[model samples]
Target: MATIQANDYLIKVDEPWTEFSKFVQSHHYSKIVILVDENTRKYCYNRVKGQLPFDHQIIEIKSGEDQKSISTCEFVWSQLLNNDCDRKSLVINMGGGVIGDLGGFCAASYMRGIDFIQIPTTLLSQVDASVGGKLGVDLKHFKNMVGVFKNPKMVWIQTEFLDSLPANELRSGYAEVVKHCLIADKKQWEEISKYDDLSQINQWTNIVVDSIKIKNKIVGADPFESGLRKILNFGHTLGHALESQLLETENRLLHGEAVAQGMILESMHSVNHGKLSQIEFEEIKSYIELIFGKLEKQRLDINDLIYISKKDKKNFAGAIKISTIDKIGSCIYDFNISPDEIKSLFSQSNFN
Candidate 1:
């Protein structure tokens, strides 16, 4: 078991189920509620049920990006109210990014704030989403356009939950792992790039630990995302735009999938700005394509992508500011970009 102190809360990664059960039994919460989706309700809850000796309500929401909205938050809030939850009630968020984001928001808003614990199940959440205190839902086509900063009481991560993950979902989660490597650890990037298979959990545990440590250290320094923390937005500017644009379409991209593409595009931006070498840029792009595949068939509109990117949270005073890597594991932030630059990147035939 590894523990990292983030903000005012403690994050416990890969801890034993017995330790978690004991934690739940010892805490004197007035009431307990678990927020889960259809996927977690079926495949994840049983993995933790044996440890809970107290009666707790389960709030099940739909399991996708489409379901993450103000309406969903209303439903979750109403459930808590209907159940007579008070200021001291504890909420356990058990699922992936969607669950942790929306559920943490609900717990934060309920009674002006209450205690919530994060139990992130998927590989993506185990490393990224559950570590930081970013909680929110998407606003229309803008990703994370509405949110608040509220840390959970504690975060519990267990790798056993990964056993039932679908192959595509597994690959999707790897994108965040790759993002961590690119932004903070060059050696990890070199190590993970040669992997032909990700079928084993033990092979991934140390990587996950390293990723969480990177996030924890950054968040501890800049909790509200005012300065150095912006580096963490490395691939999110374009990645979030793509995720938002594709949400209602036939070819919806998972969070990590979009992020993988964003990393490639931003790495190319580094090349254009003379910060990264062309050879290193191609190597990054090629490795990403080999793992996450190419999006050439999508034929995305440059104008539409530009419009969405203009609305990215990273923009300052209506100017688009993006984060790019100067080298593997090292990032430079707050550079202005134009629509033509965005168009130029999208029009390139290289990614295909």
Candidate 2:
């Protein structure tokens, strides 16, 4: 919908490959690698394939949260080596968040680094992960624990790629959109919550752009997550812990699905710790449930979830670091909470 030029990289939205093609022509790369998981390779790859002016290598990995691992990175690295990739080579990440994370990490670590572009194929990557320059694979279920802050050369976002997604995937990405509104844009949040049917409102350009602007502004302000960027993790702290904890189970959650629920509990925490009113928390919780359905946990062990969360990279010393909102559309970061507090979150929830 719009072209946003950051301090270094450019994000092209819905304008197709005009800017991307121009940028590629200027950069004389030794090789080009297009990274995809099976899902995107089958669905999203062919769209961009015809538009690319140069011949490129297609590297496919399995698609899933579980596949976002060091082992996958090794496989990508091996493929890169087999294709004679070098520092001058380029990697085009052409999938959802997992591909963006894994592909970017591979490109960044390949011979100390190479140029890479993000062509985020799913809404999750499009609005959040792809633009942030945060790249890495998960370390043993703890989400994004082994990542780096390295921005891509550019990001190309097209809404058409989202068309291939199933409803659950779109619902997963909508969690971040909801998070964006909850943390930074109350007006948008109010509007989004009023949706009669989230899926029926087909045009997502405005919505995606809005979330991108909110996130990109925050990331630009605090590129390395030194301070302000942690607000972006508002729902992610407890959300990630729950996500990691459920991975061993059959009903493991999609990243955003977990974050959506995380927001529900974190909203409760906000009322307890910050200025968010009970009315506000209740409203937030109700809206989330209306959209994503209710929290359903049969045997979630709070202690194990806390143990997994303790490994979060954002945590400092022994205190669990998180971001909580003072109110809708605003947030504070570097907030620390105790394990007792987290257990209380579970105890207070409907699931417990």
Top candidate, metric lDDT: 2
lDDT of 2 by residue, 1-352 (tens): 7888865888888885766777887898889999988889889887667788877899998988889999999999999999999889999999988899899998999999999999998899899886677888888746677988888998888987888899889999999999999999999998898885677767888888899999989988988768998898988888898887887788778889999988888778878885789988888988888888876666587889899779887889888988888889998888877888998988888963
Clashing pairs in 1: none
Say which candidate scores most in TM-score. Answer: 1
lDDT digits (tens) for residues 170-272 of candidate 1: 8888888888888888998898888757763455667778888888887778887788889888888888778777877888888789988988888888888
Give the distance in Å from residue 202's predicted Cα in candidate 1 to where it truly belongs: 4.8
Off by over 4 Å in 2: 140-142
TM-score of each: 0.92, 0.91
List where candidate 1 sits over 4 angstroms from the true fold. Answer: 200-202
